[model samples]
Structure formats: C-alpha cells, structure tokens
Target: MKLARDTWLIFQRQFLLLIRNPIWIFVGVFQPVMYLLLFAPLLKPALNAPTQAEAYRIFVPGLLVLLAIFGGLFQGFGLIAELRAGVIERSRVTPVSRLALLLGRSLRDVVSLIAQAIIITLLALAFGLTVFIGDLLLAYLMLALIALMTSAVSYGIALRVKSEDALAPLMNTIAQPVLLLSGILLPLTFAPSWLRHVADWNPFSWAVDGTRALFAGDLGNDRVWQGLTIVAVLTAAAVWWAAREFARSVR
Candidate 1:
C-alpha cells in the first residue's frame, strides 16, 4: 500500500505537469497521422490488398508499435533534464520508495503513449480500418506494456548517462536498428530468408506480428501469445533494472 500510494502521488504530479504542457501530446500523434494520410496510401499498391481497409489493417498496427517505440525511447530526455535540474537529487533525502519513483514516471509515459495511440486508432477508423472492440482493447494493453518496458529502459539509460548530448545519439543508434528489424513499415514476409531469420530474434518483431494478427482478428494466432510473453518478461526485467537505477541514484 505504501508503494502504491507513493507511486500514485508521483504519477499525479507528473500527470499534472503533462496537462500544463499538452502540445507534446498532439505533436507526438501528428507524425503518425501524416503517415496514415500520405504514406499509407502507397502501401495499398505494394501490399496488393483487396481494399484500402485491408492495407490499413496491416499498417495501423505497425504504426502504433512505431509510436510506442520512439515515444517510449525518447522519454529519457525528460528524466535527463530533471536530473540536471536536481529533481532526482532532491529525492535522495526523501522517504519515497525507489520503485515508486520509476513506476510513477513510466506510468505517466504509458498514459501519454496510449492517448496518442487512441488518436491514431480513431483516425485509422476514419480511413476504413476496422477492428473488434475486444481485440482493440487488448492491443491497447500491449501498447501499455510496450510503453512501460521501453520507458523503464529509457529511464535507466538516462540515469546512467545524465547528458542529453550523449543520450540523443545513443537513443537514435539503438532505435534505428530496432525499428528496421521490427518490421514496422513493412512486414518481414517480403524480406529475404536471411533477414527473416535475423528478425526472428527481435522481440519487437514478435510484437509487431502479434499486433498485426490481433488486428486481423486472429485470436488464436501463436504470435499473439508469444509476443505477450516476450514483452511481459522484458517489461518485468526493465522495471527491475530501472528501479535499481533509481535506488542507486537517490541513495
């Protein structure tokens, strides 16, 4: 209960700060919307789906995953800023649980990612994308988990580096390969055999495949469970590492 209460208080403080500067919320969603409007039309021909709706069915899931990845990864920048401003330093003498410090910030990032995701989903619907409500909710659940996992990792990295100059290039270096390997813009079905084999080891690839399966209404697909399991395990590991980082930094 103490941990939960501390987490909630921190979350509320962070959330209120977000509400004060909400432009980021819209700015984050804007790029995905542009991709949906301008870029996705080109995929219809390449995908050769029977209709645009079918094309969107494939594209939207990948776009959401894209959003979750970049959004969560870049969140470390904020923590870096806070650290320099002595926010984390001030916490060293506090009674707050170290785990709560990580969870509160990560949950705030997840909420923002989910809000952006919902906006993208609604826009995709307007473009003829169709998905069942149950599956859609489950997909959101996956997005939240992805956000939590990535943000925790981001925070851990930020606390270690504590410099935006270092963090920016480092995050880009990490994100670029992860994005390419994950099959976000195009499915790996079109990839050569060797590339497909390489992608098999990428957890995000499993997530993209699983999310696509869910969007296609394939509830029984093995990718769905596999993705969930991989992501859940990684999330646990990330949270543990980030919490440890917080504990060390604050102590």
Candidate 2:
C-alpha cells in the first residue's frame, strides 16, 4: 500500500512536470509525423512487397510503434536532468520506496508514449488506413508494452550515465541501430541476406512485427503472447539493472 501510494505521488509529480513542458510532447508527435509524411513516401519505391499498398500497410504500424519506443526511451533524459538537479538525491532521503520511485518514473514515460501512439493512430486513420476496434486495442496494448520496455531500458541508461550529454549520444546510438535492424522502416525481406539474419534476432523486430500484424488484422493471440513475453523479460532485466545501478549511486 505504501509503495503504491508513493509510486502514485511520484507519478503525479512527473506528470505535472511533463504538462508544464509541452515541447517534449510536440517533438514526440512531430518526429513521427515527419517519418510518416516524408520518409514513408520516399522509401515507398524501394519496398519490394507484392503490392505498394501492402508494403505501406505492413510498414506503417512498425514505424508508429517505433516512434512510441523512441519517445519513451529518449525521455529518460528528463529523469537524468532531474537527478542532476538534485531532485533524485532529495528523493533518496525521503521515505519513498526505491522501487516506487523507479516505477513512477517509468510509468510516466509509458503514459506519454502511449499518448503518442494514439495520436499517430489517429493520423493514420486520417490517411485512409482502416483499423478495427479490436485491432486498434491490441496495437495500443502492444505499444504500451513497448513503451514500458523502453522506459525500463532508458531508466537503466539514465541511472548509469547521469549526464544529459552522455544520454543523448547513447539514445541516438541505440535508436538508430534498433530502428535500422528492426525493419521498422523497411521489410527484412528487402535487406541483404546477412542483415536479414540480424533483423530476425532483434527484439525490436518482434515488436514491429507484432504491431504490423495488429494493424493488418492478422494478429493472433499466440503472437501477441510471445511478444509480451519477450517484452516482460526485457523489462525485468532492465529494471533489475537500473535498481542495482541506483543502489550503487545512493551508497
């Protein structure tokens, strides 16, 4: 009960901070819109899917979900900034449970990312993409999961680096490679044979594939379950690492 309450309090504070700073939200929406309008059309010709419409349908969800993950992951810079401002150090002296603090921070990013996903979904709908209620719900859930996983990873990175400059380069390094290898912008079938194997093993590939399936009305419960399983395991690993790093910092 105490942990949950503390977590909520922390979440509320973070939410207020986010609301006060609207630039982050604007950037989150703008980047994905750029990808959708500018990048998508530019790359349309290169996609070798059976049909151009099929290719568009396949890749749009992947890109949308990738935006969610990127938004959530990079938002850790806010946490790092807070830590540098002595907020985290002050919180450490409080009665709040460490887990609660961590969860609160992560959940804030998840919420923000989920909102970004919804905005993107609406934009897609306006562009003539049709999605069923059930499929849309599933896509939202998967995006939330992706956001949670990315938040955990970001928390780990923030705790370890503790510098905004360091976090920026790290975020770029992580996002670029993951986006390239995950087939979010291009289908794996179109990649070179060697790179195709790498895409197969990328965890982000599962997320992109799952989102693509949901949008295409082909998502199965089993595939959703598998993707969630991978996400859960990754989240656990990231949280554990972040917790350990946090503990080390406070000591």
The best candidate by TM-score is 1
TM-score of 1: 0.99
Clashing pairs in 1: none
Task: At residue 115, give the lDDT of candidate 1.
Answer: 93
- Put down candidate 2 lDDT per residue, 1-251, tens digits, no spaces: 99899889989988898899968877888977887777766554676545545656776788777877787788678778778788878876777777777778778887887777778777766666677789879778777777777887787788888888888888889888888888887767667999988877788787777777777787674556676678778877877777676666555
- Candidate 1 lDDT over 142-175, as tens digits, reads 8899999999999999999999999999999999
Q: Where is model 1 poorest over a 10-residue stretch in terms of lDDT?
A: 134-143
TM-scores, all candidates, are 0.99, 0.90
In order, candidate lDDTs are: 0.94, 0.77
| Pairs of colliding residues, candidate 2 | none
C-alpha positional error of residue 28 in candidate 2 after TM-score superposition, expressed in Å: 1.1
